[model samples]
Every structure is written in C-alpha cells, then in structure tokens.
Target chain A: MITIELNGQQQPLPTGSTVSDLLSTIGSDGKSVAVLVNQQIIRPENRPTLMLQEGDQVELLIFAGGG
Target chain B: MDLLQLGSHSFSSRLILGTGKFSNAAVMLQAVRASGAQLVTVALRRFNREQAEDDLFGPLSTIEGVTLMPNTSGASTAAEAVRAAHISRELSGSAFIKVEIHPNPQHLMPDPIETFEAARILAKEGFLVMPYITADPVLAKRLEEVGCAAVMPLGSAIGSGQGLANAAMIELIIRESSIPVIVDAGLRSPSEAAHAMEMGCGAVLVNSAVAVAGNPPEMAEAFAEAVAAGRKAFRAGLMQKSGSAIATSPLTAFLGATL
Candidate 1:
C-alpha cells in the first residue's frame, strides 16, 4: 500500500492503483467531480491508465453554492 | 426585449441569483426557479463525500434557461483565480467566470490589484470575465478596458443587508462604465434591487437578500418583479427632480375669480 494525499488527507491505496481505482475506493463515479493529481488535471480518459504514486497530491473539486 | 448582454451571451432577466446561504438545496432550487434569473452564480469547493448533496452542478443545470457563472471565490491571488476559472470551465462547459478575489474574510472586500490581474488574463484567454469590485469608477473602467463583461461593485458589505451603502460611489461607477455595472452585494430587499436598477445598473446579483428571507421562493418572485419594473422605468426615463412644486393642473383661477 502507498500513501496518497486525497483532498489534503492521507489515504493508503494499493500499489499501482489507477486514479479510477482511487475514485472507486472513495465511492466517486467521477461524473460531477474534477480530479487533479499533482496540481495537474487528470481527465476522465487519463484516470483509467494513470497510476497513483506515493505522495501524489490528489484534489477533487465540485460545484457548490456561492455568490 | 432588452436583453442583458454579457459578452456574446444575452439574457432577458437581469436578476442574477447566487446559489448560496439557502436553508437547503430543495429550497434553493425553488427560489432559483422563482427568481426568473437566466444568469446564476455558483462556486467551487473541495469535494466532500459526506456532504455530497452540496454539489449543485447537476441540480442547477436542471433549471431551464439558467446559465452558470461559476465564481472564483476562495482564490486569493491572480494565478489561483485563473486556475480555478480553467477548472470551472471544464466542468461547467461555460465561458462565464466571475473573478471574485477577496483575500480577507472579515471584510470580504475585493483586492483591486489582484482582481484586475485575473480579469486581464482570463479575458485574454477568451473567457467572459465578470469581476466583483469596489465602487471605484477608476477601477471599474480599468476592468472594462481589460475586457471584462461587467463590473460588480458591492453596495456595502457581503451579507450585511445594508442596502446600497455606497450609492454615491456606485452612481459614479455607473456613469463612467461602458460595460454593465452590477450591484453585487449589501442589498437586503427587493426595493433595494429596484433602486439599484433605477440608478441605471445593468443588473443586480443578489444572494443573502433572498436566501435569508421568510419565504425564499416568494421573495425571489418579488425581486424578479421589482427588477423588471426598475429596468422598464430606467428605459422609459425617470422624471427629473425639481426644487419647488410644479403644478400639474392649470394654475389659472376660473371658478370664482378672474383668470
């Protein structure tokens, strides 16, 4: 298992897990969420092939209410 | 129709509603429908699985004729705001971005320097930038020159419900700006929104005023009506002020005395 920073929190993921696996582990369908890995946007197509590495700073963003 | 033109997009409704501070998502959605606002503002947040219901993209999109203008609220710098704009464009598939860069939470006053920088960059990048700013004519004109679709000057403070505290300065902004001058904050009631419109503001962006009302939907409808009436009054032109009373009826005395 490797530790990856998810939304500023440390999370352990299986070695060589793709971004899709991470989304699955977190129960996210990746439909309405924007995923960023190491400050780079991880597109939906790239999420399936891109593997997560140790200390990868992953940030998920969603639209919320604001003025 | 006097459409509210922002860049290439046009909207019949001038009431811009902010998707915040509502009691619940359901109520917020209902208020949105009642407001008749074609242009709505939203914000980006870190995804929280525990509070997934807070996500408004899908729910807000369900409303007909509503266009999303996602705001860069949390960003404190120009670079952060630009980055947020890119991400929001990707998710929302819209070119409208509200460059809101207020570093201090206490006052929530926009930093003119940073906002100017962000608006310049975003406008150059082909995004329709709507910058939230102070009631400064110089700053508002600067933003317009930088290709901003509109300048949203606060009436007072955010959520204060002060109702046009800086009316004098806002009037100056409206006078000098070629782009739309929108009153974004510090409004408490529909009457305030109407007053802002009557002062020649292209539109008014309201959130706390309707969100905290007794009945959010009913208040939203009232604001919609007020905005329409004010816009019509402005277009028709208001009567000028007079120093003394001007008699509407004929002044000639004919009943009992000679003319």
Candidate 2:
C-alpha cells in the first residue's frame, strides 16, 4: 500500500492505482469533480490513464454559488 | 436590443445574475428564470463526498438559457486563480471564467495586478476571461488589451449595496474599454441596475440585491424590467441635461402670439 494526499487528507491505496481507481475507491462520480494531482489538473478524459504516485497531492473542486 | 456578445457566445439578456446567497436551489432557479439572465456566475470550492448529493450543479443545469461563469474567488495570486479557472472549466464545461483575486478578506477588494496577470494567462489558454476590477479606466483598457472578453468593474465594494460609488470612474472605464463593461457588485436595487445600463454598460451583474430580497423571484423580475428599460433608454438617446429649464412653447412666439 502507498499513501497519497487526497484533498489534504492522507489515504492508503494499493500500488499501481490510477485516478480512476481513486474515484472508484472514494465512490466519487468523477463527473462533478475536478481533480488536481500535485497541483496539476487531470482532465476528465485523461483521468483513467493517469496513475497516482505515492505522496502525490490531490484536490477535488466543485461548483458553488458565488457573486 | 441586440444580443450580448462575449467571446464567441451571444446572449439575449443584458442582466447577468450571480448564483449566490440564495436560500435554496428552487428559489435560485425561479430567480434566474424571472430575471431573464442568460449568464450567471458561480464559485469553485473543495468538493465533499458527503455533500455531493446536494451539490449545485444539478439544479443549475435545470435553468435554461443560463450559462455558468465560474469565478476564481478567494485566490490571492494569479497562479492560484489560473488553477481555479482550469478546474472551473473542467467542472462546468464552460470556457467562461471570472478572474476574482481578493487577497484581503475584510475589504474583499480585487487585487488589480493579480487580476491582470490572471486575465492574460487565462486569455492565452483560450478561456473567455472576465475580470472583476475596481473602477479604473487605465486598468480596464489594459485588461482589454490582454484579450479579456469583458471587464466587470465594481460599482462599489462587494455586497456593500452602496450603488455606484465610483460612477464617474466606471463611466470612464465603459467609454475607454473596447470589450464589454459589466458593472458588478454593490447595486442595491433595480434602479441601480437601470442606472448602470443607462451609463452604456453592456450588462449588470447583481447578487445580494436579488438573492437577499424578501422575494427573490419578484425582485428578479423587477431587475429584468429595469435593465431592459435602461437599455432602451440608452439606445433611444437621453436628452442632454441643461442648467435652465426650457419652455415647451416658444418664448417669443407663444400660442396666441403665433396666431
């Protein structure tokens, strides 16, 4: 198992985990979430192919009401 | 009136709505419909799995004719704002971005340098960048030169309801800017929206004025009408102001005198 930071929280995941796997593990739809791995944005189409490295930082963003 | 054009997109309504501070999604939807706003602004924040079900994307999707404009609020630096803009595009599927960089929490005044930097970056990235700025004509022109789609100058501080405290400066910005000038923030009522439109602004974006009203939908309708009236008035050409009142009838040749 390897540790990665998800939304500033550390989590353990199996080796060779892709961003898609992370979404499945977290039960996120991946449709409404914008994922950033190590401050680099992962486009929705590219998420499946991109693998998450150990100690990688990830942030998920969503729409909120604002003026 | 002609359509409101920003970048490659054209919208029918001149009033842009901000989707914030509403009590709920239902009211926000009603307000958007009643306001006749073709574009609306939203913010991006950390997504929580537990709150995913109640996320705003679903209800906002239901409102027809409204395109989402994601704002990079709470970002103090250009890089942060750019990152937020990219994330916003991914989430909303829209290239429209509102570059809002307010480092100071208390004042919430947009940082001009950061905003300009972000605008340049976002514009180069092929995003339709609309920066929120102070009523500075020089900066407005600078932003336009950077290929920004529009310039949104604050009428006053955000949510202050002060109603165009910098009207003269804003007028200058509108006159100097090549792109659309959208008067945003600090508008207290429909009359203020009308006033902004009357000043030849391409559009007016209001949030607290409508969302915090006693009845949001009703207020939205009022704003829509006011904006339309203002645009019509502007197009028709308002009579110039004069120091002395002029008589409707001729002074030398009155009704009986002419006869």
True contacts kept of 1: 0.84
The list of candidate 1 runs beyond 4 A from truth reads: none
The CA lDDT of each predicted structure is: 0.94, 0.90
Per-residue lDDT of B15-36 in model 1, one digit per residue for the tens? 9999899999999999999999
Candidate 1, position B149, lDDT: 95
Query: Native-vs-model 2 lDDT?
Result: 0.90
The residue pairs found clashing in candidate 1 are none
For candidate 1, the per-residue lDDT at B125 reads: 98
User: TM-score of chain A, model 1?
Assistant: 0.96
The worst-scoring run of ten residues by lDDT in candidate 1 chain B lies at: B250-259
lDDT per residue for candidate 2 within B1-259, as digits (tens), equals 4878899999889999998899987888899999989888889888788877446777788777779999999899999999888889988889999999999989899999999999999999999999999999999999999899999999999999999898999999988877899999999999999999999999999999999999999999999999999999988898999999988875775777677
Which window of ten consecutive residues has the lowest lDDT sum in model 2 chain B? B249-258
Candidate 2, superposed: residue stretches over 4 Å from native: A14-16, B249-259
Return the top candidate by TM-score: 1
